[model samples]
Target: MTNEFVLEAITREFPESVLLSSEPYGMLTVEIKKDDIKKVIHYLKDSSLEINFLTDICGIHYPEHPAQEIGVVYHLHNMMTNFRIRLKAFMTREDTEIDSLTDLYAGANWMERETFDFYGIKFKGHPDLRPILNMEDLGYHPMLKEYKLEDGTRTDKNDAMFGR
Candidate 1:
């Protein structure tokens, strides 16, 4: 169906869970409540819309926004209709845990692990939540903006050659 139809359906079903709605690059983007994310996604997949494909799940870090510093983004697709939707849930840095989607989509297990590994966002019900790419003892999420871009202690590199 059309984007408006899907948007209206979701808002009607979970009025309180939807915080904001937008169409970026012609894709339906919805900002859902952090705690209600799993519920909303389950509805979207099981309802008449048939948005069953879990395309991707990733984490985002926005250091400038304190209250909503950490976020998770879910991309869902209706393979039959060729329609897609995006859902985002944001939480504070101190409380980075959100309900796991592995119960709904089995493929979510690895994606959740990767998100946790990179952004340090914990999936509450994830069975085996661990680092997927980084070493377990790395101690910090490298994808966060808090880390410096370059190592200041390195003196062998010539900044002038790179126009720094």
Candidate 2:
């Protein structure tokens, strides 16, 4: 029922899948291999752990770490006990393909598309994997750290109104 108990259950089940485990702010978070993400999530949903709710699926950009430049975070919740845990899988920019969770969680369709639109992380097996927010021909992922944070050339808005 506790975070430690849930963590142990997962670790015991998939020792090799878990690369790292941590608890920050009392919430359990585990980093797993991208190849084993679907299997691990399936176990969490079907096993006694009962982490059936998919709260959110988002992408993260850590440009400094070349090996883990792009990461996907899956937030899962157990409605019965109100327990929550996070699963993360990271890959390099060149290798951004991840298994889609649409089969396991119907709601993952939109989330996966959004992650793809922003982080350029492709979701394999996604029914209609395309941009949910961004245009189809954007040509670049805006959420990546490689892009500039602000447009210095822009002078249309007032500095005071924009808090600049």
Q: Which portions of model 2 show Cα errors greater than 4 Å?
A: 153-164
For model 2 the local lDDT of residue 97 reads 99
Cα-based lDDT for every prediction:
0.96, 0.94
Model 2 worst lDDT run, 10 consecutive residues: 155-164
What RMSD does each model have against the real structure? 1.3, 2.0
Cα RMSD of predicted structure 2: 2.0
Which digits, one per residue and each the tens of the lDDT, describe model 2 over residues 37-151?
9999999999988999999999999999999999999999999999999999999989999999999999999999999999999999999998989889989989988867768
Q: Count clashing residue pairs per candidate.
A: 0, 0
lDDT of 1 by residue, 1-164 (tens): 99999989998999999999999999999999999999999999999999999999999989999999999999999999999999999999999999999999999999999999999999998999999999999999989999788898999988898998
Q: How close is every model to the real structure, measured as TM-score?
A: 0.95, 0.92
> Which sections of candidate 1 miss by over 4 Å?
155-164
